[model samples]
Target: MSKKPIKRLAFENLTIEFGDKKIVDNCSFEFPLNRKIRMLFNNDVNKYAVLHAFTQVEGITQGKYFFNEDDVTQFSFEEFMSYRLNMGIGFSTRGLLHNRSLQENLLLPLMYHKMMSMDEALEHLKKFYEYFDISSVKDRRPAEVGPNMQKATLLIRAFIHEPEIVFLDNPEMLLSKGLYANLLQLIDDQVEKGNLKHLFFSTEDEDLSDCIADGFIIVKKNKFEFVENKKQMRLAV
Candidate 1:
């Protein structure tokens, strides 16, 4: 007998609100497994709030986030930490540790989780440095590097741990054209190797979305709606 495939991440009767304002109002959506999704929002605040909620950086006022049939919103602290380790997040403005050097910031998650020893972690990251071509700024702190290098480092950090799902908020904001192309290629390679199962990104760049998104999650009329990519649908047909 063959084993059944696991279900993907899902939001059930989800509601996120601030004091008096609701960002996600009783929305329910199940994300497709191993697919790249673009999050489309008419409001920037709604975009940031929704992404933060998905990442568990912000609390949901109501509803449950189910990952692989488990309710993550109810997870214990340690359990949540473990859950987060499986996710890689690239923030639009901030995520890097200001006090740590670029290389150290990249190594922190692996070492802190005891995923690997210092030597092993360094060895693992070597390919990323070469691929992103940011080795020169490795020893510098986040503040010390220019915006392009900082963004490159952020991208590198996101993929270094080989997380199952990567959530990127405005991934193309400060990256140069060359770096952006490299980022896309890196995502493709990881997906092909089965290291990355899902990718969700919020971007204003339509060209970027068209290039990669297999589906879309759109915020419409205060509710979250899933839209299958027409391009993918055509390809499948």
Candidate 2:
């Protein structure tokens, strides 16, 4: 059987500090991805890790980072934008425009990617609504929707553009056990369609790591190290 060609996106030796204090010291690892399964996950090793990864505002007095196998020893604005475009990122704290209807939020990513026309965008949105089991409430405002609904909608928005990789920081933050299967299915669809790649970050639940993940890398001392696992993951669990 033929398999989708997988390429290394980026892995890094992470070393970061906060105001003369060290956090993420020497973290190194690879983001394993492929056609059949490509979801790179990143769970915060420390409370401030997410802030450091996203904003790089403080912390990380020293450490190296990488994307698509390239070393990012230092962060730059232009490079960051370009990198984000090629890849996708989703975080719990990342705000959504709750003022708009669910349908509108779903359409934003498509618009950003300069994808199909209005009609096309609508059609795509409809598909996403169906996939997320929210077709009936497409016109509802985010405030009127359930938390799961909001999360599913935003997730669809992130992947609509089929980014090289989609980062879900702590996917289980609000996701329930019942939703885990559904979540994996949603991610599986993109891989099956050869549409997008994924990177999921989690801490408490290791099962989630093996669910929609092809492989996993652990972060420590600003370096990535892989743990060997012989267990198999089911498509439907």
- By TM-score, the best candidate is 1
| CA shift of 56, model 1, Å | 1.1
Query: What would the per-residue lDDT of candidate 2 be over residues 1-237, giving only the tens digit for each residue?
Result: 112223654434456665555556655555555532322233434544633463332354444555544444465655455555555555554456878887887787667657668899988777666666888888899889777777776677667666656666666655557777776777778767866655544434667765655554545434454543424222211
| lDDT, model 2, position 147 | 79
Model 1 — which ten-residue stretch has the worst lDDT? Answer: 1-10
**Local error of candidate 1 at residue 166 (angstroms):** 0.7
Query: Which 10 consecutive residues of model 2 have the lowest summed lDDT?
Result: 228-237
What is the Å distance of residue 99 in model 1 from its true position? 1.0
Give me the overall lDDT of model 2. 0.58
lDDT of 1 by residue, 78-156 (tens): 7677567778899887888999999999999888778889999999988899877888889999999988888888888
lDDT of 1 at 236: 36
Angstrom error of the Cα, residue 100, model 1: value is 0.8
Clashes of 2: 32
RMSD of each: 4.4, 6.2
Work out candidate 2's RMSD over C-alphas.
6.2
